[model samples]
Target: MQAEAGNRSGLTLSVPMDLRQLRYFVAVAEELHFGRAAKRLSITQPPLSFNIRQLEASLGMELLRRTTREVALTEAGKVIYREALKLLALARDAEEQARRAANGEAGAVHIGFVGSSFLTRLASDIRGFAAARPEVEVVLYELSSYEQIDALQRGQIDIGIVHPRVMPSGIASRVMHREAFACLLPETHTLARQEAIDLQQLRHDDFVLFPRDFSPGYYDKILSLCLEAGFTPHIRHKVRNMLTIATLVSHEFGVSLVPASLGKVRLPNLVCRPIAHAANPSDLRGIWRQDEAQPAVLALLECLAASPA
Candidate 1:
């Protein structure tokens, strides 16, 4: 999502109570005595016992076996305690990332992009961003717009460059541009001569498509556009990377529909023609978690906006 300065920072970061409960249970399980563990945690025996019971209830698995004389961990409890420790460590790391993001000191921003997009002027801007913001590490993923959206939802990536579609509820997007569609044809193709090509004329042609996972919305958008022109696109092959797709198109494997920006590819045997009556072409957008407020995200947005294409 594109970030703009809003005076209101309504983000409230919370770790689950089950996590705290797990920690308490682990402390007790490790010591095998509530009194000793309570001493370590600076809490009383009764409360420690209560917290352990609550943890068991939340997890729906018995973690500890306790009696007046002795204490031991149940089989499930032992396994859960090990996993719980890992979860707590991860939770702590996430908290640190959030704090760094708030302070604008250090943080990581994961970015996902479609393959062909990397050849655009935006690619140069990204390199410049990396050089400019050395403290903010940007992890790049070559994914389709659809995969990018899924990654954003799962918190796998902080930002995604994608095409418009049915976005998840808690995700927000900022429209970058409604780029026109370009028809990628082989230099020797019969229809490659004209200044523009009517999409309807390509009805019987074989096509190359981006992987649906990478560009669900955009993928379907292309298909739908062809359908609207009274032809169902004959998808002969699907590839994840646009450059590879273009390379195949250059070899005349099949014609493909791509963003106008793909003209930057400049492959030797590939020619691009504007699509005639191709419905509003794909709109590239930046998407991210609605609850995420990170300076690195804002910084990237600023860089993108300031960049010249």
Candidate 2:
């Protein structure tokens, strides 16, 4: 302690403590053992003891009751220990807030989508989102509608573009577009001459279809349409994705049912014809974990909703 002399009187003055000393003192106070506190701080026992002594001397108070048999905190030490924890937490929070502001939209976002997402209008939607929010870094992963739902709940993905048939129980969805079913045929096929062909007529012919597990809704939709036409689909070959199915149809593997978006693809030996039996087309929707007040995700949803079907 230092004595400050004034014209009126003399008063004892104590040094103002720094954060490092408070941290060291708190660690030792909590552990109640020099060796353990040193281990916790990844420092040697000698340095830990020296730091604690310096902290006590600076505070002008004995913070810990030390003995050969035991170590414990004095009453004053307990008060400082509790306050130090809160101070450390607040300090960390402030640092994080500053970093977040400096980095702008620096957090990572996980994006999940249907298999044909990259090939369809979803590509344009993604490009538009990237243009608008270039600072938001996104990690894109291709997933089925069901898998997308699971990922969202598990906090695996932040956004999803999926088919409408999949129920999004805890998530929010925005209708991006509906991809109408189209008939894929060989250029020389009779149905290619017509503007559209009845889905029923093709039920008798061998067809290429997506695997049931990969796209249960899409697979079942086709099967149900065939059944409504008074026949079971003659699914001769099963493929994993739209491109593969389109390739097989181009090689005259069989006639296939596909989304109108597939028409964008130019296959030398194949033509895409609209299905006359389609009453209401399948919907392509954007799914996201619901946020009552997330401006960024809301902006993305608005973009998707305004896009063409």
Top candidate by lDDT: 1
Query: Residue 258 of candidate 2: its Cα lDDT?
Result: 77
Per-residue CA lDDT of candidate 2, range 72-148, in tens?
98765666577667666676887876665344334455778886767687787778776766766668888878888
Which has the greatest TM-score?
A: 2
Candidate 1 wrong stretches, greater than 4 Å: 1-106, 211-214, 305-309
Task: After the best TM-score superposition of candidate 2, give how far the Cα of residue 109 lies from its true spot, in angstroms.
Answer: 2.9
TM-score of each: 0.61, 0.62
Error of 2 at 235 (Å): 1.0
How would you encode candidate 1's per-residue C-alpha lDDT over 129-211 as one tens digit per residue? Answer: 77876778879998767778778878899888776777879988876545788899999999999899898989988999876
Residue 183, model 1: lDDT of 92
User: lDDT per model, in order?
Assistant: 0.78, 0.75
